[model samples]
Target: MDWKGRRQSGNIEDRRGVSPRGGNPFGRGGMRLPSGGMRVSGMSFKTIVFLGVIFLVLKLIGIDPLQILGADPGGVASEQSSPSSPRITEARKDEMTQFVATVLAETEDVWNGIMKSQGLEYPEPTLVLFSGAVRSACGNASAATGPFYCPGDQKLYIDLSFYDELAQRFHASGDFAQAYVLAHEVGHHVQNLIGVLPKFNQMRSSMSQSEVNKMSIRVELQADCFAGIWGHFTAQKGLLESGDLEEALNAAQQIGDDTLQRRTQGYVVPESFNHGTSAQRKEWFARGFDSGRLAACDTFNNPV
Candidate 1:
C-alpha cells in the first residue's frame, strides 16, 4: 500500500474538539448563575454576594430576578465545560490515517467509474476519524465496535486504534490489512446504495436466528469480496506490493468469527457466526481478486 502523495478526501469532517451540540455553554467549569442574569461560576465570593444582594433587593420590589438573567430563566445558563482535548500532534507520525484515506480515495475512484459505466451516480461517503467513542446516525458506539458504516448518514466510522488491536491481538499487520478494513466498510455503503441492505432487513423478521446469522455471514463475505475487488484495482494501479494480497488474506483469516470465538471462548459456534469462517472469507476474497467483475462477488445467490 504505497499511499504517499495520494489525494485525501475532502468529505472528512473535523469535529474532533467540538461537542456534538455545538459548544458547551458553561464556561470551563460548572456555572452558577446569579439571581438576575450574570454567570457567577468563576466569580469571586464577594462578587457573588454582591450579586445575591442585588437579586434580593430586586425580589423585594416584586420583580422576578430571573428576568435579569439571559434568555430563558428556567434553563441553566451553563452546563459544564472541560479543557480542550489534546491536539493530534502525533497524528502526523501515524501512517494509518493516510493509508485509510488513500484507500477510501481509491474506492471513490473505482466506484465512481463503476457506477458511471452502469449509468448510475456514485456518491462518495465520508470517513470519520475518532478516538475512543463516536456518535453516528446509527447510535453511540465505542471503538470496541470496530469500524462500521452508517447507511443513514452515509459515513464510515473508524477508530484507527483498532489497527493496533488487529496487529497486537489478532497478529494481523500490514498496510493492506488496514486497507481491507476500510474497503469492507465501504462495501456496506455499496450495499446500502444498491438496496441489498434494505432487502436483508426486510427478511430478518421472517428468518430464524441461525438463518439470519447465515445471511449476515453472506453479507460480510460479500464485503470481503468487495475489498478484494478494490485490491484488484490497487494492484493494477501499481499501488500494491508483492506481499500486500497475502497481508489482507491473513487479516481476513484472523478476524473470522470462528477464529475470534475460539480464541475468546475456547469454542466455535456456527449458529452464532455473523461473519463467515476463515476459509469462507479467504475464498470469497480470492474470488473477487481473481475476477474484478461485480458479478463474481455476488454471495447472495451462491450457497456458502
Candidate 2:
C-alpha cells in the first residue's frame, strides 16, 4: 500500500495494554463490569439489585460513586501499573499500526481539501487503538463488535485483531481492504459531523424496528460510498496500486449481511438486513469512486 515512511496521525489513543478486567469506578476502563461489581462471566440479578441500591444510596448522599468504588477517575487503575508497555508481538502487526495511522492522516488530508473547497471545516476525529474490550462515549464494546465510530466522542475505535479476522475469516485480505474498513468508519464520523446520524436518530424514534433497520441500510450504504469517495481521491493522487480497487470491492462483497447470514445460518432474512446486500455495497462504493462528488453518495435521497 506504500504506507511506510508516510506521515502518521497523532490522534491515536493506544489502550492495548489496559486489561478489560478489574473494576473501574470511573466508568472509563476498557473492560467495564456491570454496576454493583458484577462480572461478565457470572453475575446474579439479586446482587445487581443490591449493588444498584448501594449506588443509589451513594448518589443520594452527594458522594462520588466512583470514589466509593475505589476506582481512579483520572485514568485506568490497576495494581500492576504502567500503561502496559507498547508491545507489538509481530513485525507485521507493528506495520499495521503504522499503516492505520498513515491512512488516518491521509483521510484527514483528503477530507480537509474537499471540505475547504466547499467552504466548510473538517474537524479530524481521533482514532482509538484498543484490544479485547474498550469503553466509548457511546457504549462499551468487545472486539467482536467490530470497528465502530462513536459520535458521542468523535472517535473511531478499532482492535487491529479484526484485520486478521477480516483476512482469515471473511476472506477479505489486502492492505486496501483494511484501509476500506477504517475509511468506512471515518465515513460514519463524517456523517455525525454533518448531522446525518442525528437526523436518522430523530427519524428512528417514530419508526418501527423493521422500518428503522431499512433506514439503517441507507446509512451504512452511504458510508460505503463515502469510503469509495476517499478511494477516488487516493486513486487520483496515484497512491492506489494495481488491484487495490479490487481488494476494496471484494471486501465490500465479502462482509455483506446476506453473505454473512448465509454462511452462518444457511439462510437470509431481508428484514434483518441493515447494511444492504453484497451487490448494493459494491454498487454504492463503485458509485462514489466513479463520481467523487458528495451529492452522488446520497443514498437517502436516491434509492439504494
Candidate 3:
C-alpha cells in the first residue's frame, strides 16, 4: 500500500471529462460535431448536462457527475474537497490516478513474469480512465456499470471515483482493496488471453440466462482467485501492510451477490446470484492467496 514513488503504468487512457457521446468537455455554449465544425449537435450545453443526469438517475451512479457547466468539465479543479469521497478534487483525483498507474504496473510485472514462466509473452492491457460514460469494444458503459475489462480491445476501463464509492458507500477502504478491484478486472484480461473468456463469450449465446449466470460465477471466482495470486506475489515483495489481506477479504464480502442483494432488496435470490456468495468469494480468494499457483485456480474443473 506504500505506492508512492513506484513506477506507474503508461497504458492509461484518461478521458475523465469527455462525454462518451464524444463531446469536447472544454467547449461551452453548444456541442460540436465530430468534424469539429461550428455546427451544433442539435442540443444546448444545459441539455447535454441534463441528459447526463437522466442517464445517472436511471442507473443510480457512475464514477462521479462531472461538473459540466460554464466551467470546463475536463479541466482540473482548482479547489480541494473532503475525505467525504467522490467529491474528489482534481488534486485528489491526480493522486488516485498515480495510485492506479502504480497498481497496474505491479500487475504488469507479476503477469509478465508468470506468463514468461509458462512460455507465453504477456501483452499488457491498457487502462482507460473516464468520467460519466465511456465507449469500449464491449459497448458503452456508464461508470455505474463499474470498472470492466473489454477483451475485444484488451483494455481496462474505470472511473476512479468508483473507489470512493467503495470506501464511503461499501465501507471497503484501504489501498489494497482498491488494488483488488483493478486486479480482478486485469484477471479477466488474463482469462481472455488464455482463451477462457473467448470460449465463454462464444458459448453464452447458446446458454440460458440461468446457465450463463452459473458459468459467470465460475469465471468471476477465478478472477478473484487470480487477484489473490497477484496479492500473494505482492505480499512476497513486502509491499502489503498489516490488515491489507483483511481489507481485500472484506471487500470481497461486501460486494458479493448475496450481500448486495440482501442489502439492496432485503432478500436473497439464489437464482439471480452471478458473482457468488460472500463465503464463496472469500474462500476462492483465500485458495489462491494461499497457493499462488495456476493449478489452484481451476474454478471450472472443481466445484466453487
Top TM-score model: 3
TM agreement with the true structure for every prediction: 0.76, 0.78, 0.80
Tens-place lDDT digits, model 3, residues 69-130: 34444344433233434454657988999999999999999999999999998999999998
Task: For candidate 1, write residues 1-304 as lDDT tens digits.
Answer: 7888989766675444332322221111111101111111246789999999998999999988766665454344423222222223355425666777778889999888878988989999999887655677666655566777777678887767787778888888988888888888888788788987778867877889899878888888888888788888888899888799999999888888788888878998887888888899899988888788789989989987
* Pairwise TM-score winner, candidates 1 and 3: 3
CA RMSD of each candidate after superposition = 13.6, 11.2, 11.2
Ranked by lDDT, the better of candidates 1 and 2 is 2
The lDDT of each candidate is 0.74, 0.80, 0.80
Off by over 4 Å in 1: 17-94
Q: List the residue pairs that clash in candidate 3.
A: 62-144
Any runs in candidate 2 off by more than 4 Å, and if so which?
Answer: 20-88
- The clash number for model 2 is 0
Higher-scoring candidate on lDDT, 1 or 3? 3
lDDT of 3 at 14: 89
